[model samples]
Target: MRAAVYRGVNDVRVETVPVPAIGPDEVLIRVAACGICGTDLKKIHTGSHSAPRIFGHETAGTIAAVGERVQGFSVGDRVMVFHHIPCGHCYYCRKKTFAQCEVYKKVGCTAGFEPSGGGFAEYVRVMDWIVRRGLVKIPDGVPFEQAAFVEPVNTCFKAVRNLALEPDETVLVIGQGPIGILLASLAAQTGAKVLTSDLFPERHRIAAEFGLRHPIDAGKEDVVAVAHAASEGRGADAVILAVGGNALIKTAMNAARPGGRVLLFAQTQHGDAVIDPADICMEEKSLIGSYSASEEIQDEGAALVFDGYRNGFDLTRLVSHRFSLEDAVAAIELASNPGPDSMKIFIEPNLAQV
Candidate 1:
C-alpha cells in the first residue's frame, strides 16, 4: 500500500509500505477520503509527534475486512472511524471529560507503524475499542467527503454546546476557516444570531451560505466595533475565538458584553496567552476553553452531521481542494498555507469513489 510517511518536520513522502495486519479484534479499511485538519497541520509543522507515522485522521472508508470477533460490521460496510474512544469507567470519563481519559488518549487507528491517525494511506487498521463504540455508519447517499467530517463536526458541536447558548443571544465567531464556519453554523443552529469575522472576503462569502448575515472584515474595520454594532450597541452575547492567536484573545474579550462569555475554541497548543484580568474581574466576563470531541455527545454529534446533510447544511461546500494519495504532499502544503480561496482540503485515496 502507498502511505505518506512523515519522515520528519516539514517532510512527508509517499512510500510503498506493508498493508497493516489486523488482529481478530480489529478491522481493515480501504481508505476513501480523509480531510486535512488544522490539528494535523500543527503536528506536521511543529514536529510535535515522532516521525515514520501516518497522520491523517478525518477519515471515511469502506470496510475491507472485519475481525473474527467483531460483530455487527462486515466487509463492504461504509463507515467513519474515530481514532480515539474513551473507557467509560475512568475518572475523566465518569466526569464526562472523555478526551482526557487515559484510554482515550491513546490512538486507536494506524496504517503500519505506531498507532497515530493513519488515514493518509491506502489502507488503515481500526483497533477493537474504536470499532465497537467510535465507528459511525455513513448513511446511504452521503458522500465520503461528508462522512469524513463527522469527527470534526463532533468537535465543533461540543464547543457550541459548551457555550450553553440561549435563543435570544447573539454570537460572534472569530475566523472563517472550515472549523470556524462549522463553529458559526452550529452556534446559529441553537437559534442565536451569528456574526463572523475574517480577513478573507472569499471566506466571508462562503460563510454567508451558512446563514451568517453579519460578516466583519478584520482587515478593513475593527472587529470589536462591528460586533458591538450587531449586538445593538452592547456587544455580542458570546464571542467564540475560532482562530488561534494570543492577540485575538483580547479581541474576543472586548467584543463581548459585560458578563458575556468568551469561548476559546482554538488555543490547542500549550503556551501562555496574556489576557486582561480586568476583562474577567471588572467586567465579570467569563473566559473558557473547550477541546476535542466528547464521548457523551457522540451520538448527538453524528445526528447533527446527518441533519446538516439533509437540511442543506452540506459540509461538502467547505472542501475547496482534493488530492489523490499520490499527491498528499501537495495537499498538506496547501492546507498548511491557506489563503482566501481555500477552506477544507482533502486527500482522497480513492478519488473515483469519492
Candidate 2:
C-alpha cells in the first residue's frame, strides 16, 4: 500500500508502506475519499506532531475486514471512522466536553507509524474502541464523498448549536471557505439572517448556492459597517469568526451587537488575539470558542449529512478538486494555498472504485 507520510515540518512524502495489521477487536477500511482539512495543513506546516505519521481524518470508505468480536458490521459495509471517541464516564464526558476526555485525546485510526489519522493511505486500521463507538455506516445511495463530510459537518453543527441561534437574529459569518460556508448555511437553517464575508466573489457565488444572499466584500467594504447596517446600527446579533488567525478577532468582536455572542470557530492556535476588554466587560458581549466534534450530536449530524444528500443539500457540489493517492502532494499544495475556485479538496485513494 501507498501512504503520504509526514516526514517533518512542511514535508510530506508519498511512499510505499505496509498495510496496517488489525487486531481481533479491530476493523480495516479500504480508503475511498478523504477530505483535506485545515487542521491537516496546520499540522504539516507547524510540525506540531512527530514525524512519519499519516494525517487525513475526514474519511469514508468500504470495510475490507471486520474483527471477530465486531458484530452488526460486515466486511462489505460502507462506513466512515472517527479517530477519537470519549469514555462516557470521564469528568469531561460528564460535562459534555468530550474533546477534553483523556480517552478522546488518543487517536484510534492509523495506516502506519504514530497513530495520526490514516485516511491518506490506501487502508486504515480502526482500533477496538473506535470500532465499537466511532464507526458509522453510510446509508445506501449516499456517495462516499458526501459521507466523508459527516465528521466535518458534526464539528460545524456543534459550533452552530453552541451559539443557540434564534430565528429572528442576524448573524455574520466571517469567511467563505468550505467550513465557513457550512457554518453560514447551518446558521441560515435556524432562520437567522446570515451575512457572509469574504474577499473573493467566487466564494460568495458558491455560497449563494446554499441560499446565503448577504455578502460582505471584506477587501473593499467595511465588514463591521455592513454588519451594523444590517441590524439597524446595532451591529449583528451574533458574529462567527470562521477565518483563522488573530487578525480578524477584533473585527468579529466589533461586528457584534453590545450584548451579542461571538464564536471563534477557526482560531485553533494557542496565541494572543487582538481584542478590546471593553467588548466583553463594558459592552457585555460574549466571546466563546468551540473546537472538535461533540458526541452528543453525532447521530443528528450524520442524519443531516445523509438525509440532506437527497433533500437538495448535496455536499458534493462543494468538492472542487479530487486527487488520486499518488498526487496527494499536489492536492496538499492546492488546499494549503486555495484559489477563489478551490472549495473543498479531496484525496481519493481508490479513486477509480469510488
Q: How many residue pairs of model 2 clash at the backbone?
A: 0
Clashes by residue pair, model 2:
none
lDDT per residue as tens, model 2, 217-248? 99999999999999999999889999889899
Clashes of each: 0, 0
List TM-score per model, in order: 0.98, 0.98
Quote the lDDT for 114 in model 1: 81
Mind giving the per-residue lDDT tens digits that candidate 1 earns over 1-354? Answer: 999999899999999999999999899999999999888888888899988889989989999998999998989999998998999998888888888899999999999788889999999999999999988898898888988999999999998998999999999999999999999999998999999999999999999988888888899999999888888899999999999767789889999999999999888888888888988999999998888888888888887787678888899999999899989999999988888899999999877433
Q: Residue 75: error of model 1 in Å?
A: 0.2
Clashes, model 1: 0
User: What lDDT would each prediction earn against the true structure?
Assistant: 0.91, 0.94
- Highest lDDT model number: 2
- lDDT of predicted model 1: 0.91
lDDT of 1 at 89: 95
Which runs of model 1 end up more than 4 angstroms from their true locations?
Answer: 352-354
